[model samples]
Target: MDSATSDESIIAFDKWLETPPGAYVRAWEQACLDKMVANIFGFNAVQIGMPQIDALAANRMPHQWLADIRLHPRQSGTGRAVAVTLDSEELPFATNSMDLVVLPHVLEFSAEPHQVLREVERVLIPEGQVIVCGFNPVSLWGLRQVRGRLTGSHYLPKAGEFISMPRIKDWLKLLNMGVSQTQLGCYAPACRTERWLARYNFMDRAGPNYWPYFGAVYMVQAIKRVKGMRLIGPAWKQKTAKAGVPVPAANKHKESIDG
Candidate 1:
């Protein structure tokens, strides 16, 4: 969060904008994205605040939503895309309408993170899914967030700190989004040409797991809870009743903190 380090991050992001995402990293990201997208049904696939990569993902998986700063000239379905930009808090859709939404570092770069999340919470169905990917504050690659911004874009935050996964989980809990799973990626330094170093399987596992302190990015999947969360299945209760007179009550709260 040093002033000088902040400037450096900004410079780094500028460097990134000058190039596209690395092929290996992009492939891994797309793999994870595909898994998340495939789980939804009759739901909209929304990629917020990342028009370029969202477009890429859309192209890779034609079923995924394709977004852009401007409407796509050739694709008439561009009108179906929820046209939004940085600072656009109000969604054009109804409550509980969206089935899936992807936040590709929008939380890290947004000037009003909470408001954006609130918008997400508003549009999500009770059983909706949201996948978030962001720079890990602790990773060598996460420290390069400033590079994620375009120079002079007011959408970026002015401060810098490790945006801890735990903190994000807490925020989602407040928004009624339950944490389902998390994965860390790019634990080593961001090297475009030196990816040969990660070809070894052992280094890949150790870095993203044990050495997450050096990760470039991390991902989390959260789901909105349904009302009337059941303590026991109906069939289980009937079977247990056949064998016992009473059912013992136990701890009622279960939470995931790997936010």
Candidate 2:
């Protein structure tokens, strides 16, 4: 898709977030993001897209920004404002400057998903963390979405090229970002209305223990790693022994004279 088309799709997806199914997904994502970012220590953090969700609200970073390709009038869940508007494939920040970056459903809608991740890797400092939320294409929800596409209707946004967890892991690996943690959620069946979703709510409780990997949504946390770099602690100097030359010479002379 072209940039204009991609932008329109993102806006559409944003609108979808207000729907019942969308709201369910949003609530799950919000809770997960809150827990994931709570303890991360950092100076600068940036959330790449999906400003409707405050991905950094629980973070304690001194500098946090929400960036998107274009500004939208909608405020985030916590009323956090967008700090900058820029292309995800080409971030404006300096290389290795960001301590954390959150990408919520960004890859699925982007025209150049790999390029977006490359840009994120470029901006993140070594050992910095990145949280990515995406729709899993290997679940019942995914099967329903596929069926919807075949039937000329889409369960999720047609513009989204839903990426699988393994694929995302491979992409991050290629960028030298190691996957540190992963979470799967939204085990309920893919239902269009709130009523059906409520009926299937029991699935959410059992899914984690029965079929954990088949959740509709997945979140991954990765840390940027640089080769041949090691952190060092404070250094200490060894104490030197005092010279015993004068005492040794005098003792030797006195022993010889006595002999």
Candidate 3:
């Protein structure tokens, strides 16, 4: 999608986030993110895109930031958290600098989703945690999007590509990251009204038990992996020397004379 259309879709979705279904999604995502980030200790954490929800709110990391493609003029009003405006595909951070990175629905809305993921991998330190929120393409909401495309009346924003969980996992795997968790939520159908959505709330409990993968949204947590990496120290050196064969006094004297 063109930048204009993409921005429009994002603005529209941010507004929609205030709607009943959107509100439900926000609440669920916030709770999940809060729980997920609480244990992720790091010096610097960056949340790329989706300033509509503070993805790093519960994170205890000393330095937390929210970034997007376009900087918000009134960002200072948002309080202690720093806000940056930069292209998602070309992040400004140093490679392997961030300890935690959160992408709240960034992939589905991105025009260059693969580049964006690559950028995410670039900025994260080894073993750094990444948490992503996305709409599941095999869920009730996905069906709605398909119907919308056929009829040209998208219930969700038209700009989003609505990536599937498997596709995302493949992307992470290709980047040499191990997925640690995949959580499903917002099991209700794509209802237009809040009353209907609330009435169908029972689906949240029933859907996961009966059809776990059919939720409207999913959260994926992955860790960057570096192979053949190990830690060494003075103690390890001392232990290796003790474990090796002892040199004889005659050999030692001969070696010292040769030296």
Candidate lDDT values, in order? 0.59, 0.88, 0.85
How would you encode candidate 1's per-residue C-alpha lDDT over 216-237 as one tens digit per residue? 6677889988668567667977
Which stretches in model 1 have alpha-carbon errors above 4 Å? 1-24, 54-64, 68-88, 143-162, 192-202, 212-214, 229-259
Comparing 1 with 3 on TM-score, the higher-scoring candidate is: 3
Q: Over the stretch 1-259, how does candidate 2's per-residue lDDT look in tens digits?
A: 8878987888889888888899999889989999999999989999877877788889999899888775454466667777788888889999999999999998998889999999999999989999999999999989998998889788888889999999999999999999999999998888879999999889988988999999999999999999985867444322222333256788899999999
Reference-based lDDT, residue 11, model 1 = 47
Candidates, ranked, lDDT: 2, 3, 1
Q: Each model's TM-score, in the order given?
A: 0.62, 0.86, 0.84
Report clashes for each candidate as comma-separated counts.
6, 0, 0
Q: Between candidates 2 and 3, name the one with more favorable lDDT.
A: 2
- Which prediction has the highest TM-score against the true structure? 2
Candidate 1 lDDT: 0.59
Better of 1 and 3 by lDDT: 3
User: Over all chains combined, what TM-score does candidate 2 have?
Assistant: 0.86
